[model samples]
Target: MEFGAVSDEMEVKAPAAEAWKVYSTLQLAKLVVEMRPDLVEKFEVVEGDGGVGTILKLSFPASTPVFTYSKEKFTVVDEEKRVKEAEVIEGGYLNLGFTLFRVRFEIIEKDEITCITKTTIEYEVKEESAANASFVSTQTFVEIMNAVATYLTTKQL
Candidate 1:
């Protein structure tokens, strides 16, 4: 098994406030569930202002059952910077690893009716539990980001 991380970036046609509504809100988890109901079985916000220090209980469904990493503890949120951070993820059945994930959304207002949003994801993988687990996580990371972008973009209009 080898430790690895996945990062992805995307652009959205929405203003920063619009983007923040999706990225900064805990409700955005619902968008993830809506996009991939098969992967996101259950998600519950545990704490915080729903902005920072929020823990999400993430499980799975068929075709994308998440057997590892049961929960994520989000610790940072800077609306001014459009950034949020989470850590101490349980890489269940994998490395029992501790991981951190950060998402930043920058809104570029192009016009009154349109805004361009750029999103970035950075991850830190602490250990490798299994080769299969590593593969699954990396793939899921990309899928999750893409799903978020898709979810937000579809609502832009």
Candidate 2:
């Protein structure tokens, strides 16, 4: 099995604390759904207390270019560091040939009113599924960050 990882970083216009609140809670999904329902048809907490063990079931609309749905569980949450990690334990990624798919979101505090969002994706794709894995785009994180930043900036007004 071959392992590969991709990382994307975005400078947010809001404070680290504000960005942390958005990234560390379920609010992030809500923002995504509100801002881009076409990309996410549904977002629900299937289990857990919205913590490290929390399970989220995400459904994608038929117009979505990627997976139709995914079941992910929070594997790590470090509030002090403003970091959260989730693993796609079931759903489309697995069906598309990925043996493992995990995403890590880190909000770095640069100052009182600025921060950077670092998104990392680690995956292991089976040899037979390698051809299908090329469609995975890291730019999705950038788009999400832009949307969240816009939301936070407007909320502060």
Off by over 4 Å in 1: 1-5, 65-69, 91-142
Sliding window of 10 residues with minimal summed lDDT for model 1: 129-138
Report lDDT (CA) for all predictions.
0.58, 0.88
Model 2 segments more than 4 A misplaced:
none
Clashing pairs in 2: none
For candidate 1, report its TM-score: 0.67
Write down the TM-score of every candidate. Answer: 0.67, 0.95
Over the stretch 33-152, how does candidate 1's per-residue lDDT look in tens digits? 778776676687666557666778777775544353366666677777666665545543324332444444454556654555554545544445333434333355456666766666
- Winner by TM-score: 2
